[model samples]
Target: MTIMVLGIFIAVLTFCLELYFKEFVIQHFHSIADQMVDKNGVEPGNIEKFYSIGYHNSLIGLIIILVGFIPIYGFPVIYGLISFTAVGVVAGYGYIMDYDVIKTMMIAFVPHAIIEIIPILYSMAVGMYINKNIIKRLYLKKNNTSKLGTMCKKGMKSYLLIVVPLFLLAALVESFITTFLIDRYL
Candidate 1:
């Protein structure tokens, strides 16, 4: 639920960012693609791409789930950064294809965007929730290693149990279905 809400908000925010800083955002993505191209060189097969997506998305999930150790600032900042990158991606795709923002976004988001985005959002939500409780404990001087350990364990359990599978599914959809759809339709 939190993931859905934040994802929607971030989608809208992405549009706004597109309106204001289009060049910068598009350039950023070009640079990232350039770096990836320079590194990968040869195009990966679909299966390799799928596995790569899983690995990268899982890393994002882990960062969101684990950044709770830094309390209020860490998870939220990373979450926002991730969200900003998503926006840039949408905007950048539009620029690269010379498509209008709306058309580009329609193609980008419809296929696998929700599947890929929501899990990380949920992981970030879980991290933020745990961080809140930890902050409360600190404020009350009720904090201890055992309690924090328990919280970390509980948060990680949920993230691993829930987010990991979702990431895998998202990766599969993105590498297979989404790209196929995009190639066929767009």
Candidate 2:
């Protein structure tokens, strides 16, 4: 819960930052936002497409976890800047493109993005906590195999087992629910 709150805070903050600096942000991250409509435009038509999408989203989650190695800044890099920024940029355009912002966003965000982002946030939280523990242990000059090693092990497990599966679920939701909602309603 705490991790989600912190991550959401950062996510909103960075989203605003991206929105505020539209000119610079768009140039650097236009593709992230731009590709949503053209690329993931509609829902998957077949089971194979869903499977492919699941793997693709899972791969993205893995990449975010790997990028979370920069001590304390990894969380922001993935959640704040990369993931949310793309969505926010698109939503910004969405506001101009459509009058019904709430419905537009609901069709775009719910089911998939929610599921996908939550675990990534948890991963960031785990990574940060593990790094903090390691730093604390180093400061205290304590060395225990089960302690630090266990922490690192646990963090990875949480990310891999917990987050990845959730992402796969999100992929399924995206391919099914998101696509359905968009196709039917939008």
Candidate 3:
């Protein structure tokens, strides 16, 4: 899949960049970690944290869907940004902690990342589906509004039934299980 290739590319690029910009990358990772904490400098309780993570991811899914309207440039750019930023943080963690990059990712990132990445890729796929329909309508002189409307409705139903719930599950896993794994094993 295109999303998988793009995510792998971004992760590799970020890991390579980390070799050169270790300090900068680690600083950004710390800043991100800081953002996860509350004003009192303590992490919020699991329930509150789960809600926060779920809300943030759902907001991103909504934005990705809305950005599908731009037809060409919007989706890929946003997708790459999200992928690279996340991978970069993992790379930074590897650097600061002096762990094998791939191993660290497997142990600390993979559990929740597997769940989180799926809905994101699904969002991108939906965006691409919309783009394909738009291109067919505009560039190819195909006025298939009925078909497009049907597809759009299907996409919306799936977004509600599938993507949103997956993101919340991913958030729950990330907030609770991933944290425990990192603390206990990593």
lDDT (Cα, tens digit) per residue for candidate 3, span 54-155: 998887876676676666745634653575567765776686668877777777778877998878877877776776777677778788643767767877
- Residue-by-residue lDDT tens digits, candidate 1, 1-186: 655566567666766666577667667767877765536587676798799889988888877777766656456446735654576557645765577766656674656767766686678777777767766676656655347778778887887788888989988988888778678767
Residues 1-186, candidate 2: write the lDDT tens digits. Answer: 654555456556765665577677556555655654446576336466578877876666555655444445445344433555545555655554444757877886766777777776766566566555554555556565237567657767886789879988887787778777978988
- Candidate 2, TM-score vs. the true structure? 0.65
What is model 3's C-alpha RMSD?
2.5
Native-to-model Cα distance after best TM-score fit, residue 156 in candidate 2, in Å: 3.3
Candidate 2 weakest ten by summed lDDT: 72-81
- RMSD (CA, Å), each prediction: 3.4, 4.7, 2.5
Ranking by TM-score: 3, 1, 2
| Residue 97, model 3: Cα distance from true site in angstroms | 3.6
Question: What's the ranking of the predictions by lDDT, best on top?
Answer: 3, 1, 2
Model 3 — TM-score against the truth? 0.84
Clashing pairs in 1: none
Every candidate's lDDT = 0.71, 0.63, 0.75
Estimated TM-score per prediction?
0.77, 0.65, 0.84
The parts of candidate 3 lying over 4 Å away from their true place are 73-81, 145-152
